[model samples]
Target: MLSGSPTQGMFSNSRIGNSESPNSGASSSFTQPIIDMSENDETELLSITWNQDYHCFAAGTNHGFRIYNCKPCRETFRRDLKVGGFKIVEMLFHCNILALVGAVANSHYPPNKVLIWDDYQSRSICEFTFRSEVRGVKLRHDRIAVVLEHKIYVYSFTDLKLLHQIETLANPRGLCCLSHHSNTFVLVCPGLNKGQVRVEHFGLNVTKLISAHDSQIACFTLTLDGLLLATASITGTLIRIFNTMDGTQLQEVRRGADRAEINSIAFSPNVQWLAASSDKGTVHVFSLRVRVSGEDSLTQPNVAQGPALFHQNSSTSLDPLISTNTGANPNSTFSFMRDMGSWDGKSAHGSETFLLRLLPKYFSSEWSFAQFRLPQSTRLIVAFGSENDVIIVGMNGSFYRCSFDIVHGGDMMQKEYVRFIT
Candidate 1:
């Protein structure tokens, strides 16, 4: 996540002027310790994100969005006044148009509005008026999607322009996009009876509707490669993975009484693992397989009278759809591996619990989500945070940054870690 050494080691020798000028003073850079504001209530954070271009951290809170630049002692907090009568409730960003969905957090305000902001400038670039309060917001590629009431609206980036409008045919709750490669998307409407996810492609007429879970689809995530799709329910009980290509069911992953509701799901950059947030205030990380095996192949089940050598119970229980008989080429779909234990959700007291849990354990070298604590009792609604960059949302519309020490556990190491899922 976040990795930085003392600045003096990296930037000690520097000259400010031309070689001819012998009097040019030598310039030096020194690394300063990050100011830990958890000790003070004023610096308490609500939500934080990484501004990649700026190489610094930015956060959104009950007060306003604040930027934390690396420069020493410089002012970073900026109060947004352009979007009048709106206090930021959610901030979502993609490659373009840093979109912010805000309602009247202050009861004294009239009507609610969603503001689309430019990532770097901190200005309201586009505004959209909604009938009901916005429950969720997501931005992908050049399109911005929002959920209100039972409808999901997709719009062009900025200008608050409308693109395609779709009704969930049920209560629309959460929205997830398939990845940057395809314009396809899946919608989660928990209010509907059984957990159902609608897959729709933007341009051509191709849509797949299927029942995903026995209960509500609390959280879902698509691998960056767009190969695998994973979903978890509110019960924190069941998690399923699907193949993105043919809309086939892959694996059931896990099912049982888990202590938390699945709130957020994140895939490792390399697609080697997945991180999921639970309502019990913890995170779960699981290893992802790149290819299916002998019993997990899809060809055997559907073929007519292939060899009856393998028992039906072996391949059926893990994934009934995949077969080993037909000699069909194994599909590289991103689905869950049926048998695996969830990572432990234990927490350390006082200090940063996330820092400790996100590190590699003895048996499994991969990182996991561990429960971290806040100043007081706060019902964490949504966590758009990462190890180096995390923002936890509370029920009272309050938010705070949960900072953790960065450990070098992966290939891609960043100076500061702030993962934003839009």
Candidate 2:
């Protein structure tokens, strides 16, 4: 969902001005104008969403929508229907198929309809009409999930057959996510109670309900393999990770002590790290302590075991006295003392533990190791890139690529910047 208020009448069918190419450093211009320019200075940017693979993104505007490649930051193509504005334009990876929902501006493209557009033919192939306005639309290879105010419907993409329906709380932001893994079908949506999440595991024919937080859920995401789930609440100070297989709370990471609106949360491709963007103009990345079942040990050498050790049915606990094996290192006389000092590998050691114990839990919470600062006023979304880099896209038509130091985490170094729209 967008992080800022929607602007009306700010966009026109006018042709956008050209800018320098990101790679060639030469001036580049779009094709001849399809419609005459208006007096407006800026186009209404309704929403910006990355494709499933994060290699490209679609920008929904009043005129229509435009697709752009993310790496070199170049516009691939645009369609100026001139009919109305689009509130949501979700691309199906790099394919020509797109799921589009209209803004409340024109009757030609109503807000209560989801149009399946095949950009190759430049026309909508089929449409789904609803009684209430459509809040969100997610597309998979074999399914199409639609989100409304209080209900979610999953449909078979091949024949548009209804497969499942779920009742949820008041979800105006259309909070829902799907796992894109080829071997798994996992769907997550708001539960009947606030701060709750309902996970639907289709492959296993199991449903797990997890109470994620005390307040309303703001944002959540799932790993590509559909094994781990990350969630953030309205408080926005803490982000929690859960094991989707057994509904176990694996770990919790703090974004900050001050409450702020979390715009997005993303897990690294390797599942060794996580990143979150907040309204406070900072993007935070944290090293994950929990490991996946089949993940490469080289990805996170420090972590000893995966979440399998902390299953709900298991007797293991995070307490050092129960989980630590002091006898494993018998050669050292102070091995027990050393293990007691370090509860988790990332926790405080020696005298620092005494001071941390006196303070509130917020003060001793696990904080982000790396951060990138941006303009607080600009609404942005974040995604992981190659190596330790991150891709930030803003509603103001700005794109930034920054890399973080994995060994010595701190501020991220800017690698590239571009004004995608002017």
Candidate 3:
């Protein structure tokens, strides 16, 4: 029910900006109405994750998988169990059980399959089947990998059997696992322009094959001490940062001022902080350091500056507080240049900002609501839904939950709370 693109002008009700070029920094600003369903309900949703019990969070739609419960119900203001379903389209929870996958059978069936639900005991026990069409689904503890369509399988989450497959000759489209390394995993496929990343060591062999992004490689992350490795690329909006040992590339941050196509890359489980998402919905968070001088890289930690994904020439502009005219379009400004009079694109990009409100050209803060206009081209991913919440995911699967507080700390912050159509 998610994945979109029947065209029809890309299904719009109000993503407005029908091209509004004046610099496309787009900003008519308004958001915050459509919260939990309504305006005809349609619901297609698609991906959401966060359920090791932090109050609840699980979503994936096309016909199954829904569980929202973040405290709500002041006498029926809604959301008490409003959904909870679980039709299934990929899910994972381990130890307490809840592993799903079914959802990809249309022209009379046949599409890899694997469903194993049991959130406490809601049903479903097993199905497993694979030959194609799964595309990715991690999960670590008991270990599970599932990536069908050129193989990847793995599994063992306590008896779910099948332990090794990994065959990707090509086409994988993003898969992750390595918060601290259960065995090291990472795979990507910006539609397969071919941007290697192999790590595998389960039985020991392909112990690393990162050709690292020149193209493809759309999203990646791993710095819970698994030793840095942050990739991004759907062509460019730059975001390298490798060295997961030898893949070396360490340091590069460029953000959507022009070639925006970075959709997702996160890493803030305590490794400092580094969130990124773009396809114009923006969402940057930087603050990760380790650059000991000209050529140690993995930089971006002088602190105080916030937006501005690119543009810093004259020796990074003399750094008296970093700010070399982020204007000319670092996708519509916000690099915190020494406090340009209390810069506010809403905490930096919409928590609120209005100098007469005219901020388009790729402006960021719609806060949440990864996208509703189905039919592809939204991307926007973002992760970390538990320790302080982040989850955004939206190609068509729709998802939204934001909560950040940081405030001048190592990662610097302000999102505070953004329930954009949860």
Candidate 4:
């Protein structure tokens, strides 16, 4: 790893512009070494993603893709895709498999075309054209899931062979997630019904659906092994977890009674914790308790019962919890949480157990055991870097590294920030 310290300001992708003069001096924001591309300087960054091992990360910019090594904090190499420019791209681990989608801002490339590249050769190996514009692309070892507005096409990575096609409800965000292991294949997407999620098991050729929310599903994620799934709706106040086997609702957590758009959901590698971020500028951490044999894990309130839930019978269904959208409440985040923190099951548990089932166990009203408020921004995405560290990036052109210490209840505080690009 490089010995130099990381400050604010100094990062950008490939460019063709005049270099910064030495007299220009240091930037007010904490960035790195100064840079200057050539004259056509359109190096604005659009998206960023890390490889499976986190050894390297790729930043998609208007000019091309910039690959950076994490530990040493240096540029490994720059892959020029300047012809039309790749506004967004996905990398398959540390391998050379790269996926590209043209941005609306670029006129040179077709928005409906996908260019699959191999960094090893610095060239695109496959060119795929679709009827409608592509919203997102997910790369895997054996298969690739290309997300369109209302449909998803799965293709074999080796041959680009069409394997299956799924139609979804209005999925404008192109929200989808999959397992990390090459051997375990699980694909999740919004279901045909609003607020529902459809799970696809490609290896077994089986599928299941879970009614996860009442409003439209905003985003969702699958655990490393693909057995557990977490979902959030457009309403944004709540999140739910479901079993892929029988589509049983395992847990439900409230972001706040007030409506907020969910930005992302992630599961820790250890499966000991779950994290979430929203448009509200808050990143939350929830501790998970592992389930024991035959115990009804859903009502535990904290431990991650999903590992055990997957082992349990898939045919069993707990009394379903129908959701209602009362819209955003001024005191929704606070008042609802206060009530949840103290309400006991005795007062709510009964024949229907409606109120009890709705209690905060799975969806703890105070879902966030630890939370961090970020600078107000239009977009935010978060992922666990290590058990105690978090990596967050916002549309404001800033990247953050935060630390969560369990010894102190894990209240995350920003440890580092880099103003990558403006």
lDDT of 3 at 51: 38
- What digit string (tens of lDDT, one per residue) describes model 4 on residues 1-422? 11221211112322212212211111112111112345466567777766654556677777666666554345765655435456667877766566777777656545676666554534345556677888788876666787888888877654455777889987778888877664457899989998889998776677888888778888888876576788888888777777665687765566766778888887776665578888888888765432223323333332334344334443434422111222122122343543454445544323223554666553325356677888675577777777777777766666777877654444688788776655
**Between 1 and 2, whose TM-score is larger?**
2
Candidate 1: minimum summed lDDT over ten consecutive residues — where? 329-338
* Residue 331 error, candidate 4, Å: 18
Write down the TM-score of every candidate. 0.54, 0.79, 0.27, 0.74
- Residue pairs clashing, model 2: none
Name the TM-score of candidate 1.
0.54
Give the lDDT ranking, best first: 2, 4, 3, 1
lDDT of each: 0.43, 0.74, 0.45, 0.63
Provide the global lDDT of candidate 1 against the true structure.
0.43
Which runs of model 1 end up more than 4 angstroms from their true locations?
1-58, 67-96, 107-111, 119-122, 158-161, 169-174, 182-193, 290-422
State each model's C-alpha RMSD to the native.
17.4, 11.7, 20.8, 12.1
Give candidate 2's whole-model lDDT.
0.74
Better of 2 and 4 by TM-score: 2
Residue 296 lDDT (model 2)? 40
How many residue pairs in model 3 have overlapping backbones?
A: 19
